[model samples]
Target: MTPLVSVYIPTRNRSALLRRAIDSVLAQTYPEIEVLICDEASTDDTAEVVADYARRHPGKFTYLRNETPQGACRARNRCIEQAIGTYVTGLDDDDLFHPQRIECLVDIYRRHSPSFACSRFKYFQDPAQIERLREHRYSETELARADKLTLPALLYANLAGNQVLTELSRMRELGGFDESMPSWQDYDMWIRLADRYGTAVCTRQLLSFVDDDRSRARIRNSSRRAEGSERFIAKHARLMNADQKRNHRNIQYVMNRQRPSLGEIARNISLGGYKSTLKVLLHKFFGVAIG
Candidate 1:
């Protein structure tokens, strides 16, 4: 039998964006998929909007609503708890999937049987571009290419991005998303998932990530980033070497919109070696993304 893929989206008051997200899932080329939407006590038109989708498409959706707004991570956990599909992946309410996203994940499972799998994504400002980029890429290299990811390398960065496709059992086994994390919740989970199960793979296929304020400046303004990074370091300390810790502590400065002090920079170079320092510097100074 064909496996059922569950795509869960946890949303808040953004009914309009929720509509677009759900539409993208419905538009997927994969036939056996269930859309699990968790409405986090949205006060606006969210109830009405979800009702509209449920009315239009009966069995395709399983909606969960919180009486009071739970945080994003909690909502995601709730959706995972109720998802009936064998395979699962997350879709941020503001992001989108390629029409073939589910099909691609299913194919990956059959081919590689990795514990989990993730892929690259495109950041776009205009919503109209989703259609054009969703179906087409510049070259063949952009499709179906997979690479093995190591835990040590992942400690330096979250190569898996925010979403990964894996079995529902695997997600449950890992305890779902960590609610204690102020941010980097996905990264924390991915590292643990990869470490315990085995190495994971990343593909070059693209998902659509909305490159608006939410993805950029607003994220930098988070008050909890420093706290979250501290928690991350604490949680994953056993998995990191001394140099990785130094680099991570240095990144805490970046997370808080401050430059690393000169002494700290020298310590990174001294302890982590110049090459690792260079990698950290590129992530901090240049626009090169680490995770």
Candidate 2:
């Protein structure tokens, strides 16, 4: 029997954009798949839209709507708990998947037997740009620097992005996303997954689309950042190296909107070096991301 893959989406009040995510998942070339959605107490007509898809696809979809919002972690966990497929992945309500995404991701298991597989996403502010990148979305698949995603390197940054394809059982074992993390929840979860299992590979192909919308950006720039970053460092501190600790300590300046003193700057240079120190300083003053 062909392996089944479950694609889960957790959404809230974006009925207008939700269809693109659903359509992209349903249109996958890999036939044995299920779409599980958990709506986080949306006031909009999100239910009606889900009903329309349920009617069209019948058993192909499973929909869950919470009366009260329990945040993204809980919403995703609810969907994951009910997924019937052996292998699973996630799609943000505003993101998309190329038709060959599933086929390409599952290929990792067939070819390299990796712990997990993810593809780089094409981020766009304008939806129209997606059409231009449609050519050969799955043309290439490489070992995607699995080495960099492990240990000290991963502590420096989140190279894995937000979504990946892996076994549902493994997700359960790792215990899904942490609800307490106000931000960087995906990064935290990936670290746990990497620690539990060995390194995972990624595809260089742009098989996914991420909408860089203002709403998403607003949530990212929220005030709870200090809380989240503090928790992140506390949880992973034991595992971090001297530089990783310094790097995150410097990150705290950005999170708390505090300018580092000359002494602190000197300390950042001790492990993080000048380039990494400058990246944080630029973000603190100009609100720009270096990479």
Candidate 3:
């Protein structure tokens, strides 16, 4: 029997882009899949677009709307609460999944049986100007072999994408995504999953066309992210090693660097120096290595 996979999307006021995301899921090569769109009180025609899909596709699509604007993590949690599939994955509202993503991810999950499986993805300035890049470069041979996702690696940076496919049972056991965090909620979940079960990267590029638009830019610029980063560190500090702790403290510094404290900078450099600072930056932005 084919295991069902649920693709959940959480959105707020991005009806145009959300349409494309929904269409991408609808076009998936995989058949035994369902789509759950959690609209976070979008003030646009998000509901109408979702209704159209549900009407056309019948049982294949599910839509849940929030009464008021909650954050993306909360919206996803709500979707997870309702999903009936054995496996669950996610897509950002402004991103597109490759046609083979669902099929390939499910196959990998069956083979590895890890807590979750993720793949490499890249960004583009415009959603339409998409192109394949050799940035992540993982071979099928490599992806077939299971590798552990360690706490130190996550402390250095979050190597996994938002596009991870995880077992529904594990997600429910972990209590789903952290709703309090305004950012890095996915990263936090990945770390917790890795610590308890284990995680693997599929190496295949299964997602693409991540739009670097103003909405994402605004969230990145929010002061709430810094607070969230600090909260992540405080919550996970005890699980880290000396080097990981230094790197995490450096991450805290990077998240709130505009107020640049001389003492914090000096402390990070004194502990890790140029190499450590560079690792932190690469982990923060590019997600290079550490996987």
The C-alpha RMSD in Å for every predicted model, in order, reads 3.4, 2.7, 4.7
Candidate 3 segments exceeding 4 Å error: 131-148, 204-206, 215-217, 258-266, 269-276, 279-291
Q: TM-score for model 2?
A: 0.89
Candidate 3, pairs of clashing residues: none
Candidate with the larger TM-score of 1 and 2: 2
Error of 3 at 28 (Å): 1.6
User: Model-by-model lDDT, in order?
Assistant: 0.78, 0.78, 0.74
Reference-based TM-score of each model: 0.88, 0.89, 0.84
Minimum summed lDDT over a 10-residue window in model 1 is located at: 211-220
Query: Candidate 2 residues 1-291, lDDT tens each?
Result: 889999889999999889988988887888999899999999999999999999999898899988999988899999899998889899989888888888888876556566677777777788878856654444443423223245556677666777888889989988888987887787788778777776777776677887877656544567766677788889988888888888877766655666666677776853533456786778756777653
Model 2 residue runs over 4 Å out of place are 140-148, 215-217, 270-275, 281-291
The TM-score between candidate 1 and the true structure equals 0.88
Pairs clashing within candidate 1: none
How many steric clashes does model 2 contain? 0
lDDT of 1 by residue, 148-199 (tens): 7778777887678778898999889889999878888988988888788877
State the displacement of the C-alpha of residue 67, model 1, in Å, after optimal TM-score superposition. Answer: 1.2
Give the distance in Å from residue 80's predicted Cα in candidate 2 to where it truly belongs.
0.7
